[model samples]
Target: MNRDLLGRHRSVLPDWLALYYDEPLEITHGEGRYVWDSEGNRYLDFFGGILTTLTAHALPEVTKAVGEQAGRIVHSSTLYLNRPMVELAERIAQLSGIPDARVFFTTSGTEANDTALLLATTYRRSNTVLAMRNSYHGRSFSSVGITGNRGWSPTSLSPLQTLYVHGGVRSRGPYAQLGDAEFVAACVEDLEDLLGHTRPPAALIAEPVQGVGGFTSPPDGLYAAFREVLDAHGILWISDEVQTGWGRTGDHFWGWQAHGRNGPPDMLTFAKGIGNGMSVGGVVARAEIMNCLNANSLSTFGGTQITMAAGLANLTHLLEHDLQGNARRVGGMLIERLRSAAAQVPQVREVRGRGLMIGIELTEPGTDEADPRAVSAVLEAARDAGLLIGKGGGHNTSALRIAPPLSLTVAEAEEGAAILERALRSLP
Candidate 1:
């Protein structure tokens, strides 16, 4: 396909497509950190297509790798061993620091998560699964059941079947303030009491850092405490790094790494940036956990030929370009700038997150509705100023989720922040 900037043409969008919202822009092409439209206008992509385009669009090296692999072998079945598939799995193991960690690659994070659930249940012989409130695992039946967000309807969840724990409430935001110290400690104490009364959980899954819930990282020592509690109960601790892994978080290659002695989990799921822009995700299971692996038990096709090729290419790109290093630098800069901006503007309750995945939260000012107007004001204004962003949270409030490509330049970050600042000031 001769991919060029979108031609000047009006798209007759499908009427059958469900509308999540009334407005949807026609983005034409993307490269690096900017996207252009059919109208020949450019919008800086802070949203990075909800942070999926980690290496940017139409990246030459990644594309070339995909092309070459495609020409050679477009598909493969699990009945055979594929070179790229093995290589990709090896790369994941090395990057993840989990020795003897067996991987079950899949087409998406949700699939990997589902696979993790299967592994957890089969291995432990438990029925009840535990997850955080306001946390998003995926939209699939099992994942949605495991997901804690109330936005999901009963059609997708069995609230009676799954147990939802609090990720901790935001007294003022930054969640950093509520970190595992007091609030989390309270949760731990309460949870111990709850577990004492309620049924035992099969697995306790968590987003190493909350992704769709506004980039909320856990407070200090929180993970360690949670780990201890889960360990004592023989519950599997699964870290959902679908959004925070592959070096998006500064310093540690994994979000859990930054939690001091909190250490790793029994199982870890990674997606998003791992395959660069390609769609691929996998579950990294520790050896003790993998002892329960049953081949006939899992899906037919995982770690397929095409996806493995893309994943390898992505790993190569991260290593060669040092995107993780850039993520740290840019993420730190973004946090500093946002902290300063939020302080100056009381409307911004808190600015929290690590690396490029940052969130600018807008409190209700006085109500629980969260004043989406404040968030919309900033986002809409940014859009008018030629910047693209995203909104997420159970309340659908005004949280500006700024997760650009890890390759995002400081200049781009500065421009985006300025645009946001201008937008917030214009808010009434």
Candidate 2:
């Protein structure tokens, strides 16, 4: 039955839409941190649908909110006043940290980023932009141009002239050998040099932790240093918090906060987990930048009633439960356990990340080259052991990504880590 469904999916879906495993398992239902396949095999869900399920699977609060809102109204097309949308937007604005912040909703991170690009370019009146190396923003054409990872970028044709910058990946770069302060200085120097040779860019966009680039991050305060340079040149700074937002990083509610010594960024784009799998995304910017456009604009399905309700409920639960603190306590233990297990496996090049977003990078033993085959083997092994995880990296796609729901318990973390350890051990 699963094979038949896989055949149907392949036939109807785009080839670029990849699936996991040699034979894809059809997940039917889920609750808490666990999901059941069509064949009734239960598995612990660590990837959380690519980190979209922020709180939990089958979260009663979100489900109830969605159902109640749907029963009354599903969407109002952003034409009429949406109470839930307004409420959600207000809450996000308050939390965004951008002074006089205004929020505009979208349906996905890609669209949220697209809107951000529009705002940045319009506000600064420049087509050129700065992006980080080994970064993945979104799949939209505008966002793709800014993406530095070759594996995810499909084409060079772009609406904006994007210049890839340094500092996103700290472990495998020219500045990798330097100390933290020296690395920041080197990246800042490189940025200054790049700026001297190129057109004045509208903005410098980055992910605090590069998501698709395998959970890699630079030294703390790197962005704060970059912010100083950007401000001098009138270039806006945009923090892409799609994968790292809503306290997923544990120590910080937003990923940018780690590098926020100079205050918050000029604009912030978020998606992924906000709606807890309900497709909520948006851009938050100060009033001046957000209202730069003289003309009118509205997302047809962006701030629909149903998605807003879900986002509100999810955000409430996340805050009320102090899931961020839970993530910190639990994820710390999980990382330590995985690191101990990885020490026994030479193929495990590095185990890195913060909070619930972690990555185990694989390399051929004694070599720095990425071992994608090893990643594949561990993924298959983990699935066979009733664990569901995800994989990502730069051009090589060699890193195992583990971003469970923020509500992950200590026992679940330990269990997942054990399953992952066995999977790594099984890797040849």
Candidate 3:
């Protein structure tokens, strides 16, 4: 049955759309941190549908809200006044940390980022933009142009002239050998040098934690240092929080808070996890930047009633349950356990991340060369052991990504970690 479905999927779907495993498994249903396949095999879900399932699978609160909203009205477009949309916008505006903020909703992180780029370019009147190395923004044309990870970037043609910046990945690069302070200085110096040779850019967009870049991040103060330089040149800072927002980072509510000594960014794009698997994304910016354009703009399905309702319920549940606190407590234990497991495996290059978003980079034993084969082997082994995980990296997709739902229990973490340890050990 799964084979037939896979055949049909390949026949119709784009070839670029990839699937996991040597033989793909069909997921039938899920609840809490576990999912069942079509054959009724149960598996612990660690990737959380690429971290979109923010709270949990089949969360009662979100499902109830979605059903209630659907019963009333599914969508009326942005042409009409939507109370749920307005309420969600207001809540997000207050939480965005920007003064006099305004929100524009989109259907995905790609659209959110595309809107942000449009605003930055039009407001600054410059087409040139700065992006970080080893970063993955989105799949749209404009977003793709800014993405520095070669594995994800499909084309060179772009609407904006994007210049790649340094410092997103702390472990690998020209400045990798330097100390934290020195690395920041070097990256800053490189930025200043780049600015001198190129046209003035509209903004410097970055991910607080490079999600598709093996969950790598620079020193805590790197962005703060870069902010000083950008301010001098009137370059706006846009934080892409699609993967790291809503307290996924444990120490802070937003990932940008780690480098927010000066203040919040000029704009931020968010999606994934906000609606607990529903399609909801948006851009939040200060009044001046957000309202720069004189022309009107609206997303037909951006702030539809159903999605807004789901977002509201999910956000409320997250805050009320203090899931961020839960993530910190549970994620801390999970990472330590995984680290101990990885210590025995020489192919485990590095284990890093904060909160529920962790990455275990794999390389050839006693060498720096990336071992994607080992990653593939571990992935298959984990699946056979009744655990679902994800893989990503800048270098040939050689990192294991473990991001369970924020509401993960201590027992679930222990179970998943044990399965993962056995999978790693089983690797050849």
TM, every model: 0.89, 0.99, 0.99
Please report the TM-score between candidate 2 and the true structure: 0.99
lDDT (tens digit, per residue) of candidate 1 on 1-428: 11231122224544444322234467779888999876787989887766778877777777888899888987777667788888888878776767678877887888988878888887888868888877888767888887766655336545325777765334433343554467777767766876887667778888867777777755655667877888889888888889888788767778767643755778889877777667788899897786686666534557767778777877788779888899989889878987876676667776877788888878765454576777777777888898988887656654778888888888988998888777767766
lDDT of 3 at 125: 99
In angstroms, the error of model 2 at 413 is 0.7
Give the winner by lDDT: 1 or 3. Answer: 3
Off by over 4 Å in 1: 1-23, 153-156, 168-180, 260-262, 291-301, 366-368
lDDT for residue 85 in candidate 2, whole number 0-100: 90
Residue-level lDDT tens digits of model 3 in 1-428:
39999999999999999999999999989999999999999999999889899999999999999999999999999999999999999999999899999999999999999999999999999999999998999999999999999999999999999999999999898999999999999999999999999978999999999998899999998999999999999999999999999989888888889999999999999999998899999999999999999898788999999999999999999999999999899999999999999999989999999999999999999988889999989988999989999999998887999999999999999999999999898877
Worst 10 residues of 2 by lDDT: 1-10
Global lDDT of each candidate:
0.75, 0.94, 0.94
Q: What is the number of residue pairs that collide in model 1? A: 0
